[model samples]
Target: MPRDTPPAERGQRLAVYSHSDKRVVLHVRTNAITHLPPAASKDFLLLCPHQGVGEDDPAGSCPRGNTCQYVHADLRGAHRTTPHTKRGAVAGFYQTHLPGSRWLVHLPVDGECPPKLAILPSRCVLVTRATPADAQGSLPTACPHFTLRHRCDRGVRCRYVHAVASPPESGIQPGRCLTGGWQNDPYRAVPVLQSPEFDLTEHLPFA
Candidate 1:
């Protein structure tokens, strides 16, 4: 896993990936991610929905609308997708309102990939922000991108999960096919991160 903020520094650009005609950056109103640990290892991709995103250029105009270029995939049970074959595969990502918070994940051994992120279920952990939850029901309307402590089965603390790009409502969306597969794919056998910076996480879904 990447160090929380260093993940940002690893990024050489500000945009994670541009979908549709319009490009999507960190949104304060429409979209957001949250609840990152001080470790800063969990990387998250800020992806826009399957809408026409504007692709406006920097200090100028975009020839095409900022929309995503990746193909619409029908997520199945335990099925995973990747941006390698897609045009808008996110090569990097940026952290909002934080210094040295722009980092680009290394491309998958196969094609390209955004940085890896480890965010909890629905809780958003902020630097100085905290929101309260309700009783006997769903979480707050304003969902935090990431939470640290996610409770689960067998007296086990499943708190160290990463925030993947797949949709949350669906399962297997959290796991991605990256680096390499167990065959001709070169990255299959290798771990995503080469350095020792990321050792706290659990078995990779890809692994």
Candidate 2:
């Protein structure tokens, strides 16, 4: 099991096969993986609903004007008229604000399952997990691009990385000027000692 995998997704290796076209009979959303092969399990590709916008960039634009590129699949067929028309596959999403973009998770294992059109449980929606800063459980680092407005919009949905934000720097404290200056002197009568020895009148050029 990968260190970053969520507890919900951490299941025993129930089966393993080399066939690329084979579909593993299980619904990740329903926790109904009883049909998995009884053989020693190896890494397998779980079909994710978050197929990002296809090559048609404009086709994936959300109707709510939010910048969601991933399609919200209608796994239950809640809004499909024809089998060809994907239920959740609407032209554009009505949400004006989806917190973040969906991540494209490609497992590094060999013989990973390719995308397939199979019905599965709805609860199996894939959510991203926090990246490990190190194996020692050190604090996770945030996505550098996340600070930019474009990246911040993705919030947790980003597949890259996230972290607990540090508190903003406190406003500069009001302090005395180092150069010894005053914006306003309230003491109208500042005492001054007159130097009798140094006469400015005698040193004057006109004198």
Candidate 3:
């Protein structure tokens, strides 16, 4: 009679699959393989209930509205749908103050899942100013055409500078300057330290 191996030695060793990091179990008797499911995490995508169903009711369809906790559907594609929860029908809607800005009333949607918004950090461009001491060196000048009308007639040939804005230093919060005027007002030009000089005739049609 063959001697029985110890209880610990009788069981097959569990191996981990390098690609997926999931544990694989091997049955010694049948030579069968089984993979254990990955652990559940909050990072998983949360599908909206009203998705793929139809257009959400304009009056009110989702009870959570802006307060829905799970991730929302994408807004850019045709498959996108306004998020609506099945808990209770109230209103299905979502809105943001600015493009890429945080949701006004939404919470978890900003921090969790598909429509994650809170992770986006505020950014601004730092325009370098010309000083008398540095007149000898070449420096970038803000494009007046781009600043006033948000377009440059010269395109790439324009001598003016077009600086890309970015987030400020550590501990420094980024915000719009409302000192000169409301930044959102379309009629008024954006506030700036020094306005660039340009010929009025260049922009005039008859000139």
Candidate 4:
């Protein structure tokens, strides 16, 4: 049924952020998040800092311009000038960059869903495993079969280690993995078989 749904329709659903009562509701299928009700005294909505800074102005313009990633007041047609007070500016900056801020959350564009949010194949393990150490005097090289084919016919009975070495971090932030599903099942003791086509690190958010 998910595959049958039109991409445009899915995207439209993801863009809808509704709030009821005080708790937030997360639409896993659409990646839409309903935020908690804002406090009466504080408005959480943040305006973009580069709203009116002209390209040629010495103050410097919004680097992204029309394509700026932030929520700009001018782009939203609010027509409000940037705050001059230090307190107002600081509050706005924190609200805009807060880890859990709603403004930072965005719907996937052009059907390019985050890998962790996307429905990955249930037959694979999403977590990368650390490689096993070599025996006392044995060579540190990995098993040829496991390195070349990701698996060996001998299974646990193999003389050499069959684990895949975790790759070095690329310093790129990975997609967030929501709890639940077979890929995240805690009761399952055995790790799923790794597939050469899918790199485990690429799918894990904390990897």
Candidate 5:
């Protein structure tokens, strides 16, 4: 099994949000996201901005990063057509950062996995849910949450790789909205904006 790797060795960009407060509790890694791997803990819930956890918990609230509480929120295993569950702490403990891009990846390996890709001036691109098309044409459209923002560590322009289906379906669609979960159900994130959408936003205007 994978033991706890050192912070530097792991090289991941993980974010933790407190469910009850909706605040980014602890953020790991950095602006460089190119490795993002899943955490080996029970906390750390994966998230997709487009596939919001219902309007009540649009921000996800880090279902897995409850720190002391560790509330499960009792979410359904599959994408159920129900209202917001119990608001679990959205988890983002990572093994690496994918860099650039915006929009969370759901770790699927069946279809195109049209992630929300971002092209930064620094020439870095990955996936995340921070960029918005209305801001600059970088993001395809507002994420399902519609709260996250575009952020880059180097003051750059980011675009959304995908996002079409108005109200995301959790299932695969075409054009705008992108579906993940092609290989593993692991969720990954790349810093996109300097806003609170990302964990760093809690610190300040991200680069």
Candidate 6:
């Protein structure tokens, strides 16, 4: 028997380690993500543009530095689906500026293990254990202008919506008509035929 073992170790019960028995691992997070281990490429899907940007850069456009300003992680799927599902694989990790020294990660691994904004062990595995089927299906919403014009000027670069808008059930048309007064203009109006339709030629300026 080990000398450290107390009288309880000699009993039939197995030895157990409590949460305090484990060593607390601390990870030194940085803003520079270029040097980090190669993981999934889900940056474009992230709503928070600041994921790959520097801590001081609010625009999220500056070049990558030596440390990460946002939370970053490698996520897999949990293989479950629910009506509330809204995110995809791990997109990033961010640290809170509060005094509690909190950390957060984005996206879920599978439908079951959805990504949550919670504090986790700093030294925990970077990659989650999930392989989602529709992992790459998280697309941004379509812009309002996209609904009127089928073609979007911003194309894929537009961060706004890219989907179609549902028509209102009230029957009242939404948005101002682009034709405006042109539809009522006499010069631009189509010529009305006699007999077949009410002859409006009398009102024509050339009549």
lDDT of 3 by residue, 22-90 (tens): 111111211221112234222222323433222233114446655544323322111211111111011
lDDT of 6 at 201: 21
lDDT of candidate 4 over 1-207, digit per residue (tens): 012222234332321111221111111221221121233222233223443321113113546644543322222111112111212222222111112211111111111122211112212111122122235522222233443343333333334322222233342232333344223432222211221222343442222
- TM-score of structure candidate 5: 0.20
lDDT against the true structure, each candidate: 0.23, 0.23, 0.24, 0.25, 0.27, 0.23
TM-score, per-candidate, Cα-based = 0.16, 0.17, 0.17, 0.17, 0.20, 0.15
lDDT for predicted candidate 1 compared with the true structure:
0.23
Clashing pairs in 3: 124-165, 124-166, 125-165
For each candidate, how many residue pairs have backbone atoms clashing (under 3 Å)? 46, 5, 3, 0, 52, 27
- For candidate 1, the TM-score is 0.16
Compute the lDDT of residue 168 as modeled in candidate 3.
24
Please give, for residues 1-207, the per-residue lDDT of candidate 2 as tens digits: 111223245343222111211221121222222233223223432222222211113223334322332222212211101110111112111111233332211111111111111111112111224443346633222233331121222333544332212112242122222222222321111111221111112221111
Predicted structure 6, TM vs. truth:
0.15
lDDT of 3 at 189: 29
Select the stronger candidate by lDDT from 1 and 2.
1
lDDT of 1 by residue, 7-113 (tens): 22332222232343222322211121211123322133333344223322121232222332222211111111221111121232211123332222221211232
How would you encode candidate 5's per-residue C-alpha lDDT over 33-151 as one tens digit per residue? 12223442434433332223323332245443433233222222212211111122111221112545444222111222323322232111223333334544333332222112222
